[model samples]
Target chain A: MKNSFSAMARREAAAGYLLVAPAILLFLLIGLFTVLFSIGLSFYHLGQGSLITSAKFAGLDNFQNFLFGRDLNLSRAFKQALVNNLWVLLSTLVVIPIALAIAVMLQRISKGIRLYRTVFLLPMVTSSVAIYYVWQGIYEPEGTLNKLLAAIGLDSLIAVNGWLGELHTALPALIVTVIWGSVPGMMILYFAGLQTVDPHLYEAAEMDGAGAWQKIYRITWPILRPITVICLIMGMNGALQIFDPVWIMTKGGPANATEVVNVLVYQQAFVNGDMGVANAMGWSIFVLTFVLSLISLRILRDKSE
Target chain B: MRGKHKWSPVWMLVLTMAVILTACGGNNGDSSTGSSDVKLTMWHWKVAFDPGFKAVADAFKAKTGITVVTQAFTPDDAYRQKLTGAASAGDMPDLYAYWAGPLEGAFDGKALEMGPELEKDAEWKNGFLPSALQGVTVSQANLDTWAADEKSSDWKKERKVGQIYGVPLDVGAFYTIYGNAKLLKEAGLEAKAPATIEDWIDTMNKVKEKSDVPGLVFSAKTFTLYENWFMNFVDYMKNGEESFTNFMNHDEKLSDPNHIHAIKIIEDLAKSGNILPGSVSLDIDPADQAFAQGKATYDIGGTFTYASLVAMGMNPDDIISFRVPAYADSKVPDAKVTPFPLVQMVVTQGGKHQKEALEFVKYLTSEEGQILYANGAFDLPAVKINDTSKLNGSLQAMAGSLSSESNWWSENSAISGKIGQPEWQTFHADMQKVILGNMTAAEAAEDFDKAAAAEKAKAQK
Candidate 1:
């Protein structure tokens, strides 16, 4: 095989390998190694302050503990977190359309489009921890949201315990924050997609007596269906792995109403120091996320192909 | 041309490997032990205590000609994460601070056993409060409990029953009630902590009546103070120590009338509109800030709270500290607050400078060092200070609150180990609801009892 290649070809091949070597090595060392290590860690019981070398082989016990109710508290927390993740995923139905609507409006605007876009993108650009703190203030008992509601004579609707403090309202309050943070990125994606849509389609829709709503329903939506699918996938992945906002805002508290898989994984790993179980929970969430993403892709796939 | 560039791939691989190795490797920063330049690193999560630690470290270096480097990580949870990462990497500092109780087990294999050294040096050993040492010591009850618990295999194996692993940095309790003297005087009440639970509430009511400020404030969102310390203290006052033990051991239920009464006391206080508004949303620092800013008439905290309150700009002269007051007609009316070690300084097994680290630990708990720390940080010391004038006014007040009483639930070795169980999560959540008036105290107590039963069953399995 070496003799089959010319000297010049061999030289080019060597150069190519050299150019990509760092990236390949980095991917193997940091990315693949950690994934493989955590997967292996799931099969072992490693307590805190003990090295990985001292880990005892536990077979499937770690997974069974949470998944099979061997540990009731862990199982209940895991199931509740799984349900919360699903709720977050379900919010994409509302999130994508709102983002698309904003994008459409931005596309139609003749002035200050940049300013509107920048204003809308501010949350995306700002530090998420800072934004969570800001939102925490807004949802506080004496926060702006409750005060605004009271000012408008809707005093009965106030959450006296604060939005994140009430069990009934915590998850929804979190979901709203999640949607607000997520809308900006999806809006930017949709805006880019809308830019590629030819202006003549709107003109054609108008000639056919299609109103603005009908124009969007019949033309814009169909053309942007692929973007919608992409947004749904991104949203699903983001929601499933969402940790920082929940951690900063509620800490999966008010009776674990805002608990998600990542928060549970964090608690198991760092708080409880049950590395094996934490890794098991992490891999389990990964499997669920993969399956959900794949199913959504299959369902959203165009049959015309 | 190919031959000229042949070493490029090999060179790049070497450089990347070197970079990764360099980044992954941690240096303990220890040199020859006898050398004057030998430095030992210590880590802790006490934000307000950083300056005090620095002053002590500087004094130690001047006395011994050895460097003691100190690093402070804040907010507690982040420091736990840091320790977890360091432990996994086998790169823990020479000395670090850790919590006692269930959390001490996590550092079993890593922390150096200082028992033999303490036993040998009677002068140094006797310098610390006896209760402080008892709190850090691994008792027979700890051994039995760890052996029985399915999750405590590492703890049972690595930690011996009759040995101590760390030195107490401070002895404190979270059940202390602090009153703002300014607010008390403004309400026309005595500028002192109320004598009993009823008295406290009555004082709070007076403050509310005289001014817009609430009667009481605490880190309600954190819930540990309300659900654990305050609840347990009230339980002891109302039902006695044996009843408290029975409830923890599952021989008695939280739904019992006495326990429900304890829960109802907290509920009644909340119902009285004495708790600060939006308290359910505030954690420790924010609640402290609210108290310091005079938004509340009184705050509930521990020995550590005095320093934190003073640091937050509250005048020490304007604050009165006392134990979480007992109930009127209480079973143990004369119950005094006994101090228990909260944070412990541990020498890491992986450190190169073990002797120097041990010496640093000794100096940190020495009388002179305690005075420097207590006066500088306005924090309580584990070691008793005969010279009360050496401590700040707030620190002295905190010190005066401690006694030799050992009949409380906190002092019970068997019950303390069970206090951190998972059932408390349900209890804490319910306690929040009880404060918010969404659930009756009896209902909350029933839920806690059910949760505890479920936990007990799981533990049995």
Candidate 2:
């Protein structure tokens, strides 16, 4: 192997390594090291504001507190947060079809396709904090949603406490915001995939006496399956790690109705200063997310095949 | 071509390395120009107080020939992160301000013990009110609570009482309420303090009936505000010191009818329909802004709320302020609000300019410094000043409200430490449920007792 490279080749390889050295060093120090450190920290009982070197090893105690019922309140909060995360994940069912429908509609239109795409992608590119605030205003007790409901003679349907302020509506309101932010990238993916399908294939389907729905189902659906998988994976990850929306809008208020795992992790780590338990809960979320992603991937791949 | 490529790669590597090295290089030159000259760095999270702090620092520099550099960090949680990060890097400033609360336990061993120094200057020590001193001073109760903590290290367990780690710049009473004078007059109500909770409720209802705006508003979205800040005052007022102390110490359960009634009084206020709509979602600043904007007639906040209300363009003369009204026909009917230290200034344990930093701390807490800070920042001072007329517009009113005779719970004290965080969080959420009319106050009280019991049981284990 050494003999295979001439002096010039060896020198070129050295230069390449040297060129990438700083980046590799940074990744190791900032990214990979912190992750490994958090994993190690999950098993300890570290007091607040103490140095990491002073952390006391507590074995599985940290995990047991939040995962099992060693600390009942913590365990209950974690369970509630997990359930909220599932609700967020389940929202993708509504999100995917709407996004796919928009992609299909955008494809049929001949004019202003780029303008439509850019408009659809605005939420994805916008600052999430600013968007959360806008949604917060919309979800206020006298906000646009309630006012619209009132105007439509559905005044009985308005939430008096605001959408983000009630137990029944907070989670759903957050899910709506999540879906609104999530759909654009997914729609763009479907749109790009739709662009690849030959127009002649659709023409052939039309000549075969297929209706619009049938053509969409037979020709368009199968081609978009891979993109659907990607969307599902991304959506699942995003929902599980959802923080900014919940933090800004609700802060998991009105008695933990909208509490999600990441928000709980933040409370435990920064607010409560229970770093060990926070890290344990974080790892637990990672494991759950990994398993869920893997299952979804396998099922989707099997269907695709 | 091969020869050119070889040297090009070599030269490029050298250039990149030089740039990287230059960027990462530390300044090896000495920062201190003179051996006798002293410069101290202080950090705080108060953005409004930054200019005042700079002015005070300038005064200190002129008087003592010591340079005090003040920096402001905003939005408390981020400031905590900054302090912790700087601590980890061993690059924390000479002095920094921190909130005096259960959270202060984090800085236990990290802050320099100022008890001996404070003792040396009896005047400075006595200048701050006894209530203001409670936050910085570690009482036996504090030591006992720390000892009982499962995570307590040897230093914490061995710590004694009378250990002062910091000095407060100002004292705050969280149970203070402010009324919009224009709205009050419009409602045909007198612009005076309500003597009882019932009177306050009646006044709010009158305001609601007569005016377009709602009568009452607060940061109800802050889950801790109702239970921790407001209800504690109600409990102390209704049940008196004995019952409040027992409940705080976890010896008495919140499920008792006495505590339940306190919760019921707050629930009644909510049930009156005079609370601003969407208040359950409004945060602290927005609620104050609501009162300032004449969207609401009344607001519940602390001494800190005045500056923000004024900043929002509310006229100081048009504002009527008072403590949270006492419960009528209850124990301690004459109960008044007590002011406890809101923020503490401390010397870092490993600071380079310890002596100068201590001198600055003394100056900052001095009578002259308090007047300078209070007037400049539009804030209340910790020290008792004889000439209240010298203070700024609304601060004089706030300073007058601080009485030496009033007794109240201090969140920064050990009493708060005894209530476990999990229990406080549980009670906070459940109390919100009660206020929302989703659950009865009795039911919430029962839940709170259970949560406290569970916490105690876990602590025992």
Candidate 3:
């Protein structure tokens, strides 16, 4: 009997191992290989002839170059990218809250709420490339926006070109696009969070003579804190890693006004072919993201606890 | 505790075995097991070149029975990223198309020397124009007219500093300008194109005043429009000296009066309501579309625009070319109108199949291949072919007119060295500012000088 029981347990264990084996193998093959190889490559000088045939060890030289190199202005680019990322982050924080409020209001309404949601989320469902093209038309000097300004009798203020050309306005213009693109997702998250809030708490607050603003501030906010934090962190991370929109729309143009860190890293790696420096930059971005996420999580955890 | 204990050793054993398996599988499949045949994999971004290139590959295969695989990348930018990544990862294709200039600097010492077959191909050697050869040759040795003694001659005096590293596939000329004849007729102007910048401006103003169409359209989303304008304006303003000299020689000062004047002209074009409003938001494709749809009178573009316009269903006859004229009052005697090359292809040094690759390259640059490209793929042939009867009507006209011009240049040629220069970008932005009435031309010029000086200082280090 004991021998039979032990045989059964062993068979079950073998079956479990077999089930997970593919996943483990795939993870190691795709994810770990690049990570380990990149870590190894970080220590070597990868130039033209030496790319395949030879590798010379130069410990931390790549990192040193990233931090302070003569040949590459990585440090300056990184600083500028970080500043651009921060702009995106701050803008998202401001915009998402307002979008969430609008979403919550629309959710409460019985009529035309579906229409509102559909219209609000229309930009999200549309392809980014298409959206950028449409915006491009609207932003043209004699395009709809300028025409509107002229109609309003602000002809002197009618700068026909989009905000992309001006260094001062380019980042802000991109931020508006990012905010417009991201709000729908955030709004949906907030709506889901609102649905989970107990009706009794709101009723109790209302019974206590709490106004709409007061009730929201006192009851709804505390309950939605977790979702808000998630939204905030994800939004910031997304904004930090913004590459496609900036790449397609502006290409970090008008003098690197829209140059985020990812754009810089991409240019360094692909455009410039400075892989070693690029890898270092990638690692730096990874570290920055990890640290930022951790800090955000810690603050959230503390508040929740 | 019991479950955890059971899982620990199992996980360890599984991980170890997986590692071993991965190590075994990590071998790249490039190593030939027993096959003596050499297989070359070539990647290119040109979809149009595929059929012609495939024919050459087929011929090579018939001769050697060594398979040549050709892969085309969609969307050139994505292909470049992939190629760069592959190059860095030591897994690049055997032969691939690459751009010259700053892109060439990326793979500096890493390109293959062509074999005897290519060097001995007399037809290929004699077919290419002198300027086309200059664009491809990177080394002094490969040049037709190098200094007699390398040691005695000044480095600057050397005819060429690098070998002919790439096959001259196409002549990327910039003199081609596309204007909508329909728009011109609507504006009550004759089909005759403007001869000078002043006349061009006058015609544009008249068009704007008389018609509903925008005067001109260009993408202000990036510096492409600004750069293109600057390229032409620099030629006119400096009588074709300041910007080109500054770019070629690192030691030359960038903040010359001519460059500043060029910036002023671009700014004036923007400020004077000549350029389409909201151009900063428009990109190349949309801008081209605007021109094709008769929304704009002129598009300052290249030979590729002809193909694009035809693809958009516009009649080729309606799209006419005009040469941008010299400055109305210029001191330089030999100033000629020129435009920049759009693209150039090079082979990287890290490639394995150098000999076979060079053979393939030689085939691409041959007169037969160029003619094929010109006929089927819409490429402006690099070589001046004897037979002009087979050429497209517009191209034939362009070819006829091109010989009379004295200057030939690429757009990026002026600021080539200052590609990554931050001040160069600032210069572009300042030009925009000047056009917006935020700064004067002189202020813009001073700013450019300061930026150029800073860039020069950085380069010196």
Candidate 4:
């Protein structure tokens, strides 16, 4: 019996190893290769040569250029992108909370919950490029938004055609579009998290003479903490990596007011043919994201404890 | 129990070994080249060139019997991004199209040389426009020349200022401007185009007052529109010398009286409310659509706009092409307009079939090919083979008028830097600022000078 037990344990162990082997191999092949290759390529000043034969190692020159060089416009672009992303992050924070409130209200209502959820979730499912185009049309001078504004007698107060062109309004314009597109998904997540809250705890709180606000503050909020953390981290990461909307709608224009790090990196790698600098920018973004994620995790942990 | 434990370890060891072996085998298999068939892939952004490319590919296949695949990308910018990504991945197309600008110079060394191919056909050199040929050529010697003079270094220097790098596909003369002739006639204006800046503005003002049509439809978002307009103004102001040289060599500032005067003119037009209300947000297509619908009386655009206007359902004869006026008192002789040519096909270094590619490029520049591009697409041939009879109705007359003149220049000739071409875009944006009343004409000029100087400094390094 002892021998059989030992044999069974050993077989299970072998099966576990076998099952995980392919995944490990894939991680090494695809993930490790790209990580190493990008790092290796970052060291070289590559132009006018094949990757294998022509790339000449310049040690930390590319990194230095990206950080402190004068010829490359990368540092300025990076700063601009970071600023733009900060706006996106702030907008997300504001929009997500509002969306969650709406979702919670709808969750308590039994009659139109399905219709409400579907309507709220529609923006999330729509294509980003299509949304950008629609938003662009809305923002145009004679577009729907301007016409509506005029119909309501606010035409003289605003410049209809230059919303995206204006320095003060360009980033805000993009932020509004982004918030409108992303709020639905976060709202849905909040709804799912709210559904998981224990009804018994609310019942007990009510017996203890707790009010609606008190129940929400003590029990519901605590239960939704993890979901909020997930949303915050994901939202920050997504905002940091924003490219498609800015690229399609603005091209970081109106005098580079809407320029972001990802867009700058793209222009460097592809438009400007400065791959070394682009890779450096990529690694910089990676480090930034890592630091941010760590900070977020620490905050979440502290709050939970 | 001892026997079972020992057997279990052996089984575990065997599984680990098998996994490691499989991984190693997979890695090895993946790296090996597949089947012997030599496949050559080419990528281009020219959708209009699809039929032409197909014909060439067929001809090449018939001659050498190699399977050549061509992919055409619409909306050129997106295609460029994809091609750039492919190049970074070391999976660039075997053949691709590239523009000759400071922007393209960033990838110059990576591009394949066609020096050997050019050596094979001397007649291939004769078919291109002298100016067009001068636009693409870059040489180490030319680089040395620019490097030799410290004083001249700050001036815009081309990558290869005078070398022919690519075959000239098409050349456009900047003389043409599309106007609502019916509106012009209603304004009590003659059928003839404006001869000077004063006449042009007067005509526009008249049209604005008399007709329901707006005076002009120009998109503020389009860099090309701003460039074409600004270049025509600058060209007439400076006569024929390159604007950069005038600024750099003669201490001529962008804030010079002539340039500021030009900005004021464009701004005045904007303030007149003669432009469409939301022209700032309108892109090239919708702006052109507005023009096509006769919402405006004038659209200062490319020679290709003539074709586009006709295609948009306007009578081709009703559309008359005119030269954009220079200064108020500027004579018609001094108002000679220069057009900018879009860069076409380039042969890359990674091209496996350079011989065939060169043959294909050569055929494209041939008289037969020129005639085909000209007749089929209404494109102006790069070579000055004055055969307007083959062209469409009104275009033939335009071509006839073009033959009566000499010394036409391309706006691209004004670009001096190998990587600082975005300054042109910036210049246009500054012009927008001036028009929007965000800045004065003097301020716009100063800003332009500063921006141009900064770009020049960046490119010099």
- Top TM-score model: 2
lDDT (Cα, tens digit) per residue for candidate 1, span A126-182: 999999999999999888999999999999999877888788888999999999999
User: Which 10 consecutive residues of model 1 chain A have the lowest summed lDDT?
Assistant: A46-55
**If both were scored by TM-score, which would come out higher, candidate 2 or candidate 4?**
2
CAPRI accuracy category, model 1: acceptable
Which has the higher lDDT value, candidate number 3 or candidate number 4? 4
Please give the lDDT score at residue B304 for candidate 1: 78
**Candidate 4 on A63-117: residue-level lDDT in tens?**
7765775533445456767788778878867877877897788779999788988
The predictions' CA RMSDs to the true structure, in order, are 8.2, 8.7, 11.4, 11.3
Error of 3 at A255 (Å): 4.8
Whole-model lDDT, model 4: 0.65
**Better structure of 3 and 4 per TM-score:** 4
* DockQ-based class of model 3: incorrect
Ranking by DockQ: 2, 1, 3, 4
Candidate 4 CAPRI level: incorrect
lDDT of 2 at B116: 92
For each candidate, the DockQ is 0.25, 0.33, 0.15, 0.11
lDDT of 2 at B250: 68
Per-residue lDDT for B181-277 in model 2, tens only? 9888877889999988889888888888787577788887786676555677677778877788888866788878777765666567667777776
